[model samples]
Target: MRSVDADLIRQPASVLAAAISEGEVSSLEVTKAHLARITEVDERVHAFLQVTGEAALAAAELVDEKRRAGAKLGALAGVPIAVKDVLTMRGVPTTCGSKILEGWRPPYDSTVVARLRAADMVILGKTNMDEFAMGSSTEHSAYGPTHNPWDLTRIPGGSGGGSAASLAAFEAPLAIGTDTGGSIRQPAAVTGTVGVKPTYGGVSRYGLVALASSLDQAGPCARSVLDAALLHSVIAGHDPRDSTSINAPVPDVVGAANRGDVRGLRIGLVKELSGAGYQAGVLQRFNEAVELLQGLGAEVVEVSCPNFDYALGAYYLILPAEASSNLARFDGMRYGLRAGDDGSNSVEQVMSLSREAGFGAEVKRRIMLGTYALSSGYYDAYYGQAQKVRTLITRDFNAAFDKADVLISPTAPTTAFKIGEKVDDPLAMYLNDIATIPVNLAGNCAMSLPVGLAPADGLPVGLQIMAPPMADDRLYLVGSALESALTDKWGHLLIEEVPSL
Candidate 1:
């Protein structure tokens, strides 16, 4: 392989797209550089479930052809990206990190994937994730856990860990991930990347495999805030197919990112999202970031969202109920992982056998919990009450937003934990999303960007910024401002500090 332009793998997606468009470097070269990097490190990182080099090269070549012919290209044309396995891409195998759907190839592209293609971004392949998007750590994935690029022994964060890992590992400049109770933000927090969960339905959910229909939303993941904004602009819009999708003009996120000015903006620090359970070092970095934001002419004020305390409990109940219903379609009679196919066995027996052999422990636990919650005489007590808590959380956000333009918190309570540290302890694992779950519950948009390394472990720490629903541009304005200030201080991006894998 050519060593020249090998550095392309480390360039941000924004930079690569410009170079490719200006004819400084062909799309094929940039694509090859990233594919080679994936080949070199993915064995250890295990970020990719599949790598479609042949198809990726073909797409790149087409982009080059379009440019040479003076044809109009999409905004992100020629940039390579990774897709979370939960989104279906035409003919690409989407396993969602479970064995039940092992070899199933989706017949058509999901709305997000279709948008990526429309923008001329090359899809590298599907990424690994927690089985059925059910775990805080990627260890629940049937394929194996995605290791943290910062420290191999540590976790990369869950459900969307592979998407965050790919960016940190230099396997892809941009990737897509879904956030259902912090799947995208928590992973980005621990791995020192940028993740966005746009307001629920800001981006259509037509093709994303459902974890929780009410809470699931797909967004962008990248090494820098600007790149994430660019991807968000490309993929966000209403689709008639998704009844939940918001019908409105896409926000000017890219413009907000470029401005990077937070002067006179009202920044609220969520009182309920701090102290006690939070790691001291994480709090230290978050506080320091607040000071920096204040220094940038933004007013910092304390705001209370007391209902956030009940967000986790409510999220667990709501998500499992939806997941149980969504996963019921994957029985033995359908495609992928059919077991006990004997004439003597009844249809019920075959389904029981297939599900038993195919599901991972974590997936089974959620399914059972969901079934019990929805059972007769228990619906009102569990699922119904959880919905009431959800309403209360939204009301809390509404009251807080009345005082502040945007709210702030630590992205996660702690840095990346060891891979096996919390696998056996579900309750402990769930705590990692304490700060992020509230945004999902309220259907508001949020972004997680690296602030600095935690003093305790030298791992990355993230600052989460939240905006009211459809006010997503507020997140980019603040995130980009804070990001630029931190970079100036450190003289480099937080991801630049990652050690060689």
Candidate 2:
């Protein structure tokens, strides 16, 4: 690999795009640099399950040709990105980190992937993820866990760990992550990256393999707020194919990011998310962020969302119930993995055997929990009550929004933990999303950007900013403002501190 290529992988997507457009660099060179970076570091990180070097080069070449012809292009045209395997692409295999869909490649791209192509972004390949976006850490992947780039022994955070890790490892400049609970933000938090969870229905979910149809929203993961905003613009818009998609104009995220001024914003700190069970380092950094925001003329106030206390309980019931239903189609009768095909076995027996062999322990655990919760005797006691809790959570958010223009919190309770530290302890694992879950529960927009490093572990801490649904531009404005202030304070980007892979 060229030494110059080494520098290209480290540059942000926005800079690369400008360089490519201005003829200071070719798109093919940038794509090749990232692909080479992946080849150099991915085995140690296990961030990508697959890498499409040839296809990325071809796409980059097409963008270069267009630029030479003086054709108008999308703002992010010719940038390279890593896609979380949960979103389907026309020719690439999307495993969703489950054995059931081992080699299945969708014939058509998801709305997000289609838009990326329309914008001329090169797809490096699908990154690994937790099985069907199920786990808080990437340990649930059938292919094996994705290691943290900062410390390979620790996790990069989950469901979307591969997406986060790929960015941290400098394998890709931008990535896509789906947030159901805290999948996107938590991973970004632990990995020292930027993750955005757009308002529910803000980004189309038609082609995203659903974990919970009501909660899943796909958004961008990047090394900076502006880079994430650039990506958020490309992938987010109303899609007629998605019933849950919001039929509204996309927010002015790019403009908000560029403006990056929070002079008169009211930033609220969720009372329920603070204190107790949170690490000292995370809290220290969060408090510092609040002070910094205040210095920038943004007012910080404490707001209560009492119903948020019960969000964890409600999300578990809702996600598993939806997951059980969505995964039913992956039985022996369908297109994915098949098992127990002896002629003597009945169809029912074959179906049971196939699922038994295909699913991982965590996936099966959730399926059983969902089945029991939805059973005739327990439906009202469990699932019905969970829905009530979800409503209360949403109402709490509405009240909180009335108090302040945006909400703030530490993205996760702590920084990156060892890979196997909480894998066998499901409750401890579930607690990681406590700070981020309520946003998904309320179907609003939120973002996690690096605030500073924790003194205790010397790992990154993320500051989460939230806004009311459809007011997503607020998230970008606040996030970019805070990001700019933090970068200035530290005299460098947080990603600069990551250890060389």
Candidate 3:
């Protein structure tokens, strides 16, 4: 057998899938190459919480056997992909980076996992995440933070940091992520990968562990726009099990990616998202992306979504209240961690003690804030009022969409910050998602793709493209255009600039 080239791991998933389907390489060889790559750099990246090498190899073998037997295969067959830890995979330890569920192995696969299996994608094990998907940086994880591959001292943007970092570090070609606020996009922004939050119900939520139920939506993460669209095509569509799932056809995402044309498309620039608080380097790259889009024949105009100003405030209150309700099931009597059960304490005492011991500071803080907001005395003032603001934000999106086919902004306020910089200050940490929160509130689709590296710090920067609800195709249309233009200017993908480990 020929030796697996080291550069094989660096190839995009689209290229790998084609190679596997055309008999250019065996599935096991591809899987082993990625596993070897993981071994080489994962210590510094810390992208995965667990590595399912045995299972991955076994799955890859099945794909090879199917090809030998002349059976038809899915588009992504034999591709190795990382799963966010928050999504359940039957019999796999599905820790959402919280000690409360540390050793728990769910008995069922999430809708997303089941889809991946059906598509014949090899599972590369679960990646790290913020505890209960609360923090903007992976530092809130109980296990420890995932370091950015670009700069070891900085954070890989959170909640889905592990997923994005895996792509940036070349540990995996494709990964899964959930966006409740900016978990998916923010991480992709900082890590210089591609992440998309499909229209709220365009993808099923049956298997994603709920963060803020209304805001949570699972999407694809990859190194390129086309790769993300391919994965998105496979995992999307209506599922009868999830009541909130939209009973509609999935968009032609792959087609849009292949189209990659922005001609005659009216792209809106969100006024409220780009001004003060944004870093200088971030703004510079963002302005360049706008010019690139305009050069591609995209008509750019400034549009205001004034209610976006309250999106952050409303998101905090709403997320906590829903999280408080969803997490109420983790009492000591359940399958997760149980503490103070010496038979000397009451059931309630054990439950309280278990929760106190299991949750991290950020989780505990949110739970408390949620509990308080939902209390009878404050319900009308806090939670109710926040819901009203949510309606206004949605209205703002509706109005903005009337004038533009898509909206663009810098995916985040700044490049990846040092790991410990904002961990201590909750308010500072919450501000990281400010630019991403409104899309969630409005139940729209959005994506973040690398624009260029920040000139000052030499870190990757991302540009966000948001589309109207169910018009997810528009995101791909613009994302692929800019991705191609930017790649031409840089002479290579931004990820190629990652320092050697």
Candidate 4:
């Protein structure tokens, strides 16, 4: 058996699928390669909360047996995929990186997990995440922080940081991640991986532990756009179990990836995102990306999304409010960690004590803020007004599409920062997603791709591409085109081009 390098694990899923279909490698072999890589590198990266070695090997054996029997296989047959802990996987402890759900096993799989299983993917393991998917860095995980693979001291972007970091660290070829405010894309941006947050409702949320019901969305994180698209196709579709799941037909994302032509495409550059908030190196890389897009014949146009300025404030208000309500189910009686108090204590007392011991400070703070936001006197002033602002943000996206086929921005203000840099200031950490929050507020589709390395830190920076609701295919088209052009220019993928640490 040949050893797999970091670059091999970073290959597009299509290439791996072809290799598997041709009997070049057994499913078990591929799974073992990834698992071995995880064992070798993950201790330093901290990408996974749990590594499902036993189950993954068994599943891979099934795939290999089926291949030997000449049975048909799904497009992703034999691929290893890491799942974020926020999504429920039956029989596995689905701890959303919170101490509260430390040992709780879900009774059923999330819709996305079911789809991956049906696609014959090997479930590598559940990756770490921020508690309830709330923070910009995975440092908020009750378990521990997932370190950036590029520089061990730096942080991987969150709350999907572990998934992104796993790919960057070559622990898994593909991963599933949830995004409320940039959870998928921001992490991908920093890790130099590809991550997509599809249009809200495009993918079913059934069995996913809700943080902010309206904003939370599950999508793919991978080393390339095509790999992300391949996973996206398997996981997206209407599901009756989730009322909010869009009934719209899922498009051929893989086909879009193959098309990779951005000629005559009208790309919108949001003026609001290009200014003071962004790091200067990020801005320079972004401009270079724009030039590359133009070189590929894309028509770059400035588009104003005025309401975007208020998106962060509105997002904090709405997410906390909804999260407060969704998280109320964690009271001691139902499930998860219970305080050691005796049964003689009142139910309210037990619940309070359990939450105090279970939740981290950030989670508690958000819960309290949410409780207050929904309180009588503040309802209209906070939650009510935030909803209205959400409407306005949605309108801004709708109007932008009138002038452009897609919108673009720097995925994050800067590249990966030191792990503890923003941990002390919650507000500063939240601000990291400023470039990504409006997409969730407006229910649009967005993707982040590595554009180039930031000069100051020589770390990778990502360019974000977004499309209006249901136009997810356009993002693939643009992102694939940009990725192709940029890689050709740089002589390797962005992550590959990084200087060895």
| TM-score for candidate 3, residues paired by index | 0.99
**What local lDDT does model 2 show for residue 194?**
97
If scored against the real structure, what TM-score would every candidate get? 0.99, 0.99, 0.99, 0.98
lDDT of 2 by residue, 1-501 (tens): 687998899899999999999999999999888988888889899999989899999999999999999999888899999999999898788899999989998888999999999999999999889999989899999999999999999999999999999999999999999999999999999999999999999999978988889899999999999999999999999999999899999999999999999898898989999899999999999999999999999988899988889999998998888888878888868577889998999989999999999999999999999988899989999999999999999999899889899999999999999989999898999999998998898899999999889999999999899999999899999998888998898898999999998
Put down candidate 4 lDDT per residue, 293-386, tens digits, no spaces.
9999999999998989999999999999999999999997878988957969888888999999999989999999999999999999999999
The model with the greatest lDDT is 3
RMSD of each: 0.9, 0.8, 1.2, 1.3
For model 3, residues 361-383, the per-residue Cα lDDT tens digits are 99989999999999999999999
* Angstrom error at residue 489, model 4: 0.6
Model 1 CA lDDT for position 417: 93
Minimal lDDT window, size 10, model 3: 1-10
Better of 2 and 4 by lDDT: 2
- Tell me how far the alpha carbon of residue 314 in candidate 3 is from the true structure, in angstroms, after superposition: 0.2
Pairs in clash, predicted candidate 2? none
